[model samples]
Target: MAREPQTRAETSSSPLEPRVREALGQRLQELSYSFDEMVLRIPREEMVECCRLLKTTPGLDFKLLRCLSVVDYVDFMEVVYHLSSLSHPHKVTLKARLPAEDLRVPTVTTVWKGADWHEREGHDLFGVLFEGHPDLSPLLLYEGFEGYPGRKSYPMPEQRELYGE
Candidate 1:
């Protein structure tokens, strides 16, 4: 008999899963869960450890870090990580909140080498610093550029240089 592959929702340990949720709750602080997608809002200090566990845990093997993105809300920034279980058939989203002033989070490159460029891009655009990142140089911006050009407060330079105004 042939078996069917499970959808992410089917195979994934829902954010509400007792075993997974309990394990995370014990290690992390200020944790919150969304009932719908089961996205976890992990504290910035615990993100690296949580990510490592999510990647290594047996039943909750969230090995692949598929996407990384950041949202700047002026007062705070959110770093979102989309993880998938390649060996098994599951997925999870982990979010770490960082203060706008500090803008620092532990590097997850050790857990997933591919985080290199993603962290760089975030640093380039949002000025989010990934502590312990081997290379946090700007990925899309030229070196020596001042201010994070992507921030809302960054002034838009006049076109006088090009227009001769």
Candidate 2:
């Protein structure tokens, strides 16, 4: 049967290719991968392992960890890792959500040596903790700073805690 190219839209209800569905089930059962993009959620506990696979896996050769940044929602944090493949010229995004309590994730430095400083910068501003990051402290901020400036919940203390109350 002839089928039209799927359209990108506000809502999608499409059947998966047998292989993609199988791979998605085998690797990341919790999240179904988008066929249009390789975007997938690596389980929080398996993040480091997933990055290791990304580097070594065929076809999805995400050899470079180009960016490590974060999004700070008031109640939680989302870590974004943008990776690119030198050979394939393709890209993938991996995201993990962590609670504010234990805001930690394993480092990708072992997979991408460039991740060291990117993780550090994330820790400095947004307070993301890269578990195996070589250096996770103060790339810019000095000691005794009360809060992570970039967190949405982190209002300037002078306005609320220090002077107001």
Per-residue CA lDDT of candidate 2, range 1-165, in tens? 222123243324223223233444555533333554455566688777777777776766678888888887666777878888899766666778787788988888888889888888888898887886776768878876767888876666466655655
True-structure RMSD, every candidate: 9.8, 8.5
Cα displacement (angstroms), candidate 1, residue 90, comes to 1.9
Instruction: Give the poorly placed runs of model 2, Cα more than 4 Å off.
Output: 1-37, 156-165
lDDT of 1 by residue, 30-138 (tens): 3334443456778888888899888887888887899999877677788989888878666667888787679999999999999999999999988999999998877
Among all candidates shown, the one with the greatest TM-score: 1
Error of 1 at 31 (Å): 6.6
Please provide the root mean square deviation of candidate 1 (C-alpha atoms, Å): 9.8
Give stretches of model 1 more than 4 Å off: 1-16, 28-36, 155-165
* Model number with the top lDDT: 1
Which ten residues in a row are the worst by lDDT in model 2? 2-11
